[model samples]
Target: MGSNYLLSPYSLKGLQLKNRIVMAPMCQYSVMEKDGKPNDWHHVHYVSRAVGGTGLIIMEMTDVEPDGRITDYDLGLWSDEHIPAFARIIDGVHRYGAKIGIQIAHAGRKAEDAPEPVAPSAIPFPGPEYKLPRALTTDEVREMVRKFADAARRAVQAGVDTIELHGAHGYLIHQFHSPLTNRREDAYGQDLARFGVEVIEAVKAQLPPDMPLFFRISAVEYADGGYGIDHAIQLCKAYQAAGVDAFHVSSGGEGPAGERKPGNYPGYQVPFARSIRQALNVPVVAVGMLEDPALAESVVGNGDAELVAIARGLLRDPYWATHAAYALRSEEKHVPQQYERAYH
Candidate 1:
């Protein structure tokens, strides 16, 4: 493949994506009044991106439990009532020739500003205003696993083509993987990978056999002795064996503010995805600061990753895929008919 690769179609477990560029899941925080239901705003927001020519639109992280939400306004998939709202959004996206995937997560100890947060340990986030999360009992941990499965089932019922497990971002799942947060002797906590493995298994059991499943993993915690790129490769291999379709490699979030890396440039995290892809046979999606269309295309062309996901860049211009297609000189890309007058 050349550096200026053309956008093309791809498939994941029977779900056909019209192109390689994907709109990464971004927190809209515009849910309907804490009910975690999508309303007209979400429909307009996501549908606009789809119509603007994104191949796949990964919806924002939706909490599997109410208290698991990152913010009170974040979306939720824990209840049957959320199905109708999501169904509308999915339907709208499909109409524009785009496939939609929902990213489901449990915020765990990182759940701040919510009514309550749960985690493997009671250790609170180090921030001054961070609230201490209640450590979950064995039974509670089991229940959280069930919540993830139930949420996946709900997403399927709502007509989503794929479901993504939000296991990164120092959330509940990442907490279990990080030695800094998960310090417990229980079965779920004794082994750092145990919690995440169980959650993936549970969610897989509930989803349809043909439904594509993806896991978003923090490729590096960026903290001393924290989960590193090598550990992430191991986790990717484990989940691929467990039947995950792809891995979304991301980094950062483990201990405190000092743990984060500043001065990020374009394609800063591409190496994480490349390393994971090289280590494991599973497909990988590269994210982070992938603003330029040509740079995003080079990631796939150079074998850095199988898919390129853009968040803020896509938000700045939803027609990024169309522009990327033009840059690559690929006529197969889907540019909305309405935008034809402007682009032509």
Candidate 2:
């Protein structure tokens, strides 16, 4: 395929991206104090990537509630006061010609270091050291859904280009979706897909029609009796029917981390995205240790996925997409105009 194949722009809903490469949301744990708010570190960090050349930069897994934080320092958008901090970051990202997206989430059973973790059931995450989560009441679950929608509304007010529901890596939404964690016999637990579908529908209902909605899903649980790709495909179909704009395909994290493939290799989890993309006509983003630009290009060129999101690769070097542009022979692809002087 032509080198331009990797350089070509893509669209999700009405949001147009500069290229097929995206900066996958990775928790930085850099929030200001225990207040759960974004700070200059977040602004400089994300803006630097936008300035470097990333087509889209998804801000870290922002907590939707105070107790939902994975760590005390996680960013949050659950209140109106948090809007201005993110607004600054969003403005800076736009200045560099990159679109910004936020990964709104509730950690549930995965709420690390919190006084109490919450989930659909009282099941402890399958690790000895992990805390057992208290089961949320039916009303509490409904309130969490509203929290997600409220966060989406706050994101819009902050001028974020898109909103990605954090449904992956065994967080709150993932806990409800996986049979291994959601043991309740109620509407959410008895119907494995009901919880996630409800959250997506609720969030979508609160957002503007033109705003793109992205769902990050852990395609497999990587443990015996855990949910797998089949369930993921079903979830994708449900989200598509509910007007979701894209799927961020990811895997592992329900059980022991040791159960997953140890090393990060080129395009290791591309198959998950490939499978989901084929199952649904909606765009799919392939993430997970995709370090090589050529390999990422091949993923898109081969139609395995529409977008390739680089996490640690971009963290290691913010100029990843710029270098990828050179490797792909599309030197001007995503570089900011001001950087053109340095390049030449």
The reply for model 1, stretches above 4 Å from the true place, is 1-6, 257-263
lDDT of 2 at 309: 93
Residue pairs in steric clash, candidate 2? none
Return the clash pairs for model 1, or none.
none
**What TM-score do all the candidates reach, one by one?**
0.95, 0.96
Off by over 4 Å in 2: 257-264
Say which candidate scores most in lDDT: 2
- For each candidate in the order shown, give its overall lDDT on alpha carbons: 0.84, 0.86
